[model samples]
Target: MTDAAPSPDIAVLLADDHDLMRESFRALLDASPGFRTAGEAGTGAEAIRLAREYRPDVVLMDVRMPEMDGIEATRRICADPDLSGVQVLILTTFDLDEYVYAALTAGASGFLVKDSTATELLNGIRLVAAGEALLAPRVTRRLIATFTGKGQPAGSPRGLDEITEREQEVLVLIASGLSNTEIAQELNVALGTVKTHIGRLLNKLDARDRAQLVIAAYDSGLVTPRSR
Candidate 1:
């Protein structure tokens, strides 16, 4: 009998201005299981071109680039209808670059510090490829610290008025860094119920992942850093 087919490797594109960083990441991904390096790019413009060419599962984007910045590249990639399946993960020098928050706003799935352990980077790629957001508590905290009190009016995403009150509560809890299980326990609802609410929130807000939902909650003034 024929053997069952093997799972396909998660294709990744490494985008950094430095050749050393790209080579290092490619080595790590090559040595790991369930991963394959699709290609590499030294500029944001090149990253965009390679993204169209390779259509990788994830793009590890460095924020600072020579021509265009990583944030702009991320915005273009995310905005492309043909590249909907691609997710960008920002890499920076700090735990969170001050601009990392902006990268998230530009449609990156999440981020990793340049010094992250190999395990962390690999897991982040897997999570993003599997359509799960890579937002950890620390990432969420960074986002909150940067954009929570600019006095941006609520309902910035254009459909906030349509969400039910319960959905709003769930969004607030999400921005506060509560996991699905935690939200379920806090609301005394079944976990499935929480998932359903989040699904609806995603649809109404036109957000691709929970990271964007967190941004929406803050932009809408539904949950503020001071409040959390």
Candidate 2:
């Protein structure tokens, strides 16, 4: 019997103050197909250095690190004009309302409760790497509600004017939690085309990742999450 060849290599950096958690995530990510643990850090400062030196494709960060904290580190990481392609995924034990919104706005590609299974973890990393926002439909709606103040109109109505019409359409669906494949089918365009549009949208919007895009979509008033 032949074994499946590993997936293409994905460079990963782990940042967590908790040694156990760091080791655990490192093992899970290493076990996943096509993933490599480039480095691990116990604080936000270390995370920043490893991120700059290793330049991993994805960084699994913890929000409560000492010194800089994950949110600040995330902001710095995403702020780097050179490392625009690197994605940061926040992993935390607590899904506190405050932290969730802050992390996403701070340029995290997504936030995952620490209880997530290995499969979910790997999938989240892959999705973020593929330039997709990791927020679930429900989570996205909650974020919109929290930041937009429930129908009070998002930031300047013209904030989204920078995005092209096609890019706007893609942003709307993305904020709605539709995957690229789903968006392609809904828009009747090729999947690769959808990806290209998303990439351009991110650059045009000055968003670091899909999660930030979701925040921008809501903040820019491009799309409103319906109220129940």
Best by TM-score: 1
lDDT of 2 at 133: 65
Across 109-210, the per-residue lDDT of candidate 2 in tens digits comes to: 787778888888898888887766687665566556665545454574333677778888898888877778989999999999999998887777767677
Candidate 2 segments whose C-alpha is farther than 4 A from its true place: 1-8, 150-154, 157-159, 162-169, 184-200
List model 1 lDDT by residue over 68-116, tens digit each: 9999999999999999999999988764466787788889998888888
lDDT of each: 0.89, 0.80
Best by lDDT: 1
In angstroms, the error of model 1 at 127 is 0.8
TM-score of each: 0.92, 0.78
Give lDDT for model 2. 0.80
